[model samples]
Target chain A: MSRIVLEGISKIFGSKQVEGVELIRQGKRKAEIAAACGAVVGLCDISFDIVEGEILTLMGLSGSGKSTLLRCMNRLVEPSCGRIMVGDVDVTRLGRKDLLAFRQKTFGMVFQHFALLPNRTILSNVGFGLELKNVPAARWNEAAMQAIELVGLKGWEAKYPHELSGGMQQRAGLARALAADAEVLLMDEAFSALDPLIRRDMQSELRDLQQKLKKTIVFVSHDLDEAVALGGRIVLMKDGEVVQIGQPEEIVARPATEYVARFVEHIDRAAVMRAGQVADRSAPVLQPTLTVAEARIRIAGEGGDAWLVADDDRRFVGCLLAARLAAARPSETVASLLEASGEAVAAESRLDALLARVAAEGCVAVVDPDGRLIGGVGSRDVVRALAAHSAESQAGDHPETSILQQTAGAERWTGASRNFPSTRSATKASTGSPTMALG
Target chain B: MLTTALVAVPPWVFIGLAALATYRIGGRKIGLLTLFGLLFLWNLRLWQATVETLVLVSLSTITALVIGIPVGIWFALSRRAWRTFSPILDMMQTLPSFVYLIPALPFFGLGAVSACFATIVFSVPPVIRLTALGIRNVPTELVEASDAFGGSTTQKLFKVQLPLALPTIMAGVNQTMMLALSMVVIAAMIGAGGLGRAVWQSIQRLEAGAGFEAGIGIVILAVILDRSTQALAARARPHGAA
Candidate 1:
């Protein structure tokens, strides 16, 4: 029920919205729409779901409308045309009173500047949302204390906002949102104001807090590395439109637009690329049942220190060193001479974590969640994955079609767009899947 | 009736209350000023007239604030309202202060009523202008935070805007009080009796010493009022406390 689905959300900012909205519906870009209607285009035909209990990053450069899109979810910035469905409720259709009540029950928001009330003590600031909800003072205070302790600011509750450092003030801001206990947390660049070191601390602590809390969080950021550190799907926006939406690794691996590719070009590829994604599928795998002579014949020309041996079912059996295979008598089975197994790294593990093993062993098996042998990630493959920071642009992809298809329940007719062969094939892997999962 | 009830109370009681209030809110120095300023006025035999002026200013400042603040808030919230009201406020400020008395005399005949009416008209613009300015000056992100949390309009005003705007509103209140005091002599042109009447009578009789004494009495009262309100506004700010 926490799934927030935005369908064809478009926001045009200015009194000339009727003309701007019509121009947008006619497939006008932001600049052209502004030129034609004299209204700044805020968001254009955005459709996506904020998956429950996961941090979905709205990532883009400044002025890309990521913050505006986040605000639209709670109707803080109303969309000119669209339907916003939060759980079963249509947030766009709700009246003023109903929307206020529903927002109180559903969303807790944090800001980039740590918007703590300067007049109130930390306890009162943390309990502000509850106070707005008309919660009893004693109850709100107790609940606020719990949130303050959760954020590690228990002893600082009596202090004013200005007395605390920037980092501590942000912790109090996060505690304020948590005290509301709403299901979704909308954090708009919540750490952008802090100095770099403190910003890093807040990012990791927010990730840890999200793990313990399990609240659905929609975080807006212009930093690619911060989005990757959050370990969630990225909805990369551009010029008031969603350019691409995928996991950090997937966006880095196969960016859907030239702008997105450029934005992610400088991101640390080793940290963003996953083990399964970087695995060398071209590596020859020998079966454990194969005779030693048969294995030698199968691996005659392939030059490597070891070969990953798997059973017939593709479950990884063990690594068979080249020396052992060469020294073995023709009568010995491949399984009898194999090294210990269970050395496979999970598919979801980032490539950086697998680098040490790959460098030490010269070969490491990458397995799926089921422990099935996917492929091996070797030193060369790791280097290739890191160096290949996707300079190739996804220029001809129909991003709008792919995004609509990816986020289902947007049954509106988007017309026939079969010309984009790359988009059609690229979207096929996650078609109808609930989320744009991490690779 | 209310003015008589207030005046019949012993002057020492008012003096003591003012001292305690200033001490608690404005600290020791302003508190001592309050005690001695009243004593000095009593020693000059100007205590009764000073009390009458204090009552008139208090009544008018409250009346002006009650009317001005809501109008300011409405103007700030609506661009069209601001567009319409901004010019009127400009006119109000630029118009001769004596013009307000011209209208007040026709509506409310001589004595305290006309004096109170003229002072209210003269003092209300700053309250309205500063109230709107304070609210508008609230940071955008803070307002957005409140809106995102689903705060009702009333809740946002009281909890966020009003509390943050306290210092600015207090400055406006101080200005209103000062403006009210400046009107005292002019208000004495009518039948209103107070420190203003003392100064005006001394001027008519050509008694320069009496006029100077009454003028010093008003100045002492002004200092006491300004320092106390300023301290009250300062205490409301937690940021400065740090």
Candidate 2:
């Protein structure tokens, strides 16, 4: 179930809020609405579902209403008109008192600049929400310590905010949210203030923490790299409207608009795309039950030093070496003649991870967690994928052509990757490797 | 009732306590200087006038704080309230010191009470202005943080805003006390009994020696109150782990 759902949420910030919202109903964009009424459109009919236990990023340039949308989730910035449903309760309909209690109970937020009480120690800051709720010190302290430990700040709890590093302070901010045990976290550029190396560390740690804690998080950021590193479904916003909402891979492969195309244009694809996404799913396979003579005849034209052998259910058996198959008896099954010579990589592995194995062994078998064969990645496929990306990027003169292919090639390519610029050599090399072996 | 009891206390007793509080908060050096200075006032037989001056300054400072701080907080929190009253506060501060006595003498009729009343009116502006400034200048982001975390208005005032603003507000209190002390000699013109009267009578008789002695008395009292309250402000900072 969706933990939070925002529907037709529009916020117009001016004395003419009525006219601004009416203009929105008449299907006017931000600039038109502003021109018609002296109102600034903070948000424009935004609708999106925030899945439970998922980290959804709201990304945009400054003033694109990403922060405004996040605050509206808890009514921190009251939307002009909308239905915000958190479970069964419609948050927009809540009175001030109920909204405060609901916000205290459900949402924990961290700001771009760590908004810690300067007078308070890290421990006290972590326990602040509990203190406001009148939770006894004994209980709050225990919860606070657990959260402090979770964020890897054990001995430093007694230090004031000024005493800690920016990263440490943000950890305390995170711990404060966790101590309240709130189910939803709204973090607005939580690590944007940190140095780059520390930002990366925090991003990875937060990703790990989310996996363990499973709190629904709506993170607002302008950095595409941060969104990619967060590994969540991203909601790309521009001019106070959602341009596209999808997983990083989907957005990269098919940007819904030019804005989205430019947004993901610089993303490191190898970091985001999995081997399953780039695998040659249509490659032919051999059943382990097939006889060596039958396999040789069945693969007469498909010349190769090795062949992937799988069972009837497509579960990976092993690779069949060409020499071993040729030397085997005509009645011998391919399973018996199979040699465990090649690497088997999980389908979810990244292409950067597969580069070395593909360089070492001419081909690697891609399998599911159940050891079922999905497809194979040959040196040719790797070069072809990389070449297509390089060619698209180099063809940057045509934005349309680049948008059609958003994948980024790896920076490092070896001798094996350089040889196969085309499928003809790729097919020829498969036979050539074995002939070289025999010679 | 508290001010009457404070006034009734022997001069030595009040001096001792003030010395102790200052020593505890301001450190031992200022404490020792205060003890020596008060003993010097007694040695010069100016103890009675010093006591009267102390009573006046103490009563007026307390009254100003009680009335000023809350009004200041109200002004800080409400923009319209501040906008309405800021000019009145400006007039209260800048009008002639004698203008205060014009109202005070007609209402209370020339006595120490009248002098004390005039001193309260004369000294309250700093505390109110600075207190409002202190609260108003507290970082808006911190206030926003407090609201986002569901802190109530009262809770935000006491727990977040006031504590952060204490240093500035205390500086205001110090200014108010200093103004009250300086008002004592002038207040003697309205028949108040204090070192101001000593200075005034000596001035009338053309006895520079007696006037200078009483003038020294006012200086001693000023140093004692000023250092003590300044120290109190310093101590207001909550101690935390190093």
Candidate 3:
């Protein structure tokens, strides 16, 4: 299902390409290689597969080679050594003429500065790629007009790029890329030039468009927030190398390197972490069929104010509170004692939104899409979720208060923030019971 | 050829057409200036000499543009070519115009052909230099955008770089035209007859008054051509731009 696969890609920008590449293979770092042969290392042994119909962001600050890596996908910046495979074709091996034709058909690109041609009208600029393919004028214009309308520039088709405002110019740039109907979109800092408010709007709109169009996108960005806002797997890079690649939450939760941990240190943990990530999947659960006599014995080993109950099929039935169980008749079915307050938070719900619910209910059932009970999130779980971050360790004596202070005005973090389906922290020691103890 | 054909059109008709052309291109002020300017030339009996000079300048400029533009494009797109060919341009510009004329006299003989050959050699450098500058000055990001969408080299030139460079290229054309006009008097020494010939003949007879009259006629023509081309370049700028 991968649209593009890049393997052993290393680009050395200098006249001494062969020597620089050999140095790279021999494990010389960027500065060493550059000093030895006067070659600037642009990318060093980059390998990743772009999944079909997903946005993958290449993120790093300036000089990280993120932009160079994006350009290398379509061969705008050719790698000194690499194998590039796009849908079964070896893109690097293609002849010059064939590469041009393939590039024409396979990729639609947008630029950071809205690089629309100054002389052409929006309509003409949008249709430039089609014109290159010798697509007939009437057909290309129709396609272009459709794209213009799609990007909400319907009435401004006749205006030149200079006539449009910065945001509008960016929309026209997006329209131009969309008009090509190319299978993959490689956007290089496409919206970094826009103001923050407009950038957020463009990010959400692009996310929506990508879903609707189902085009695979590889977006390059220097901003971590932008990468998070785009809601894709982030490829964190530094010094011409990938430091880590994962969903935003996974990255924030478990950074592979000190560098990566530093990058995620300032990120709002509550805003990025999902309920599933904080869910106590190892917690013991009682079956609804169990009587009060049977549930009491089962709950003896587990320490909780309440226990989530599920049917045999693992469908979430409800939770049995200790107070409710204490008042129940011995022979009564556990199902009859199930509390009305029990509500399951979906596994995909952001942890920030469920803070009050978990506080009010003591605990809540975390369920999968089909209402299958996966685990539980309690007051402890919410506090633990917030406390697990590296930031908390730096918070000293009042870490909890410092973390809570951010939630007071965290409205900005809630802007169409996409959540990565958080993974269960199975590696942590069981605070409840062994896995699948849902008996 | 065009100068010879205009000889039969009569002075009044030529004046009327030129006035109309300036009016269409530069508006009322320039139209009026052309009207009075040519009338003054007629009154001075320098009209015939003026026409010959206009035709010669026009021919030399057109030829320089036709030959220089592609070379300029080649230089802009390839640095290796620019490095190799730029010295030739520098030499062409610095070499005394008469030095080339001495070498050219054998090939073109004398009269208008020799004059035209010298005028072109002296004038082509500006167009070539400016055309290369115009094309090269197109923002790198814009060119990258075109290439990102898979524009071929020729497609990028005609569609993106060429249109953006038009205003600059037109300015080059104006420079070439100006250079061509300045070469006319020098060309007169080779037997090409025009306002230049009048100036030359006046110089030979020590007639300072007639030489000044011919010089004034050339000045008027320079102003007219300069203003006309400036108007054209302004119009060539991309629409909706200030």
DockQ values, each candidate: 0.60, 0.41, 0.64
* Backbone atom clashes (below 3 Å) for every candidate: 0, 0, 0
Model 3: how far residue B58 lies from native, Å: 0.4
Q: Please provide, for model 2 over A226-323, each residue's C-alpha lDDT reduced to its tens digit, 9 standing for 90 to 100.
A: 99889888888888887777777666655566667667777777766666656655556789888877887877876445677778988887777666
User: What tens-digit string does per-residue lDDT give for candidate 3 at A1-439?
Assistant: 3389777678888698889878877767789987888899998777777889999999988999999999998899988887788999988888888888888889999999988887789999999889988999999999999999999999999998888989999999999889998999999999999999999999999999988999999999988888888888888888888777778877775556566767777787777777776787777788989999988888777777788899889899898887888889999989998888778989878788888878777788888777888788877767766755644447444543544443322211221123354333311211112221110
Fraction of native Cα contacts kept in each candidate?
0.76, 0.39, 0.69
Q: lDDT per model, in order? A: 0.82, 0.80, 0.83
> Chain B TM per candidate, please?
0.95, 0.93, 0.96
Candidate 3 clash pair list: none
Give residue A283's error in model 3 in angstroms.
7.3
Best by DockQ: 3
Model 2, residue A256: displacement in angstroms?
Answer: 2.0
Residue B138 local lDDT, model 3? 94
Write one digit per residue (lDDT tens) for candidate 3, span B1-242: 78879876799898899989989998998888899999999999998899999999999999999998988898889999999999999999888877767866899898999999999989998889988999999999889877878888888899888888889889999999998998889999997888999999999999999999999999999999999888888888887656
Q: On a 0 to 100 scale, what is the lDDT of residue B40 in model 3?
A: 94
lDDT of 1: 0.82
Q: What would the TM-score be for candidate 3 when compared with the true structure? A: 0.86
